[model samples]
Target: MDGAVIGLIGTVVGAVSGVLGTLITIRLGGAEQRRTQNDQSERQGRSSAYSALVTACSRTYRVGYAAHATLQAEGHQQSPNDAETLEEFRSAVEEALEAVSVVKLHGPNGIACAADNLASAMSGWRSEVELLADGRGDDQRASEAIELYEELEDRFIALGRETLSGVPARP
Candidate 1:
């Protein structure tokens, strides 16, 4: 009977279509899932990098502040300041600058600007330290160092404020 044959053919076609449709839908869903996962991974990587940069900058800033405090506390304004003390302070500044450089935090324009300012400040501070360690200490050098360190402090403060606004704080 044609009716029976037609029914059989329709069922076979319907079953085949259902199977093909399911395979296509599964493939599409898999592709979508992969895209979603990739997006999440990229976001997490960005977040980690951002957090690391901020942490490195903050830690280096704190070190610079400590060095500044030590310099001031150790007969800062007096003539004939201790060579050892100045050298130690210089070392701290150098170490902090190295720390900042290793982070490679310059990016996203605004962050880059802050990083540049901070780098300039660090360079100035390190130069003064080198001068002092080289027995080239002078009142002028000390005054200049103070100015440079102040700029460094300002940059870090600004960075911290901006980063805090963007990055979540610790729980």
Candidate 2:
């Protein structure tokens, strides 16, 4: 209980407390850094998925529009390349549908819903084109279908932008 002994005990306690604090700080900092990195990675994945969906949808729309226009102009004539065009349009739609799957996997529900809407729009357009080829639809109907698809596509793009930019979706 001499002054030197008391001082030594006090110094030891202080050193132990300082080490524990440093360890705790380091652990917490590491956890925070890891959490941030994970968030960033998830965002990147979602961005990629959204971009892919957009690209796929665009391609499908273009192919479908072209096919529909050709069918309207040719009046059901079985041109040699008509088969090829049909195949291309089908492939594009399949790709877009697959991209929608990717978006769903990386989704926050809102973007996924938008993606689904776009996909449905594309399918509707494709159906209109099929009806056109079958003489069940006219040019005006094809045009309307395209318009609907474009509107849905714009919605999807807007939602993707908001999601990627960290803006919350409006309810």
Top TM-score model: 2
* Model 1 lDDT per residue over 122-160, tens place: 667656654544457554665676676566556655654
lDDT of 2 by residue, 74-161 (tens): 4367576877887898899999999999999998898889888888888888887877766677778778888999998888888888
- Candidate 1 least-lDDT 10 residues: 99-108
What local distance difference test score does each model get?
Answer: 0.59, 0.86
lDDT of 2 at 43: 94
Using alpha carbons, what is the TM-score of model 1?
A: 0.55
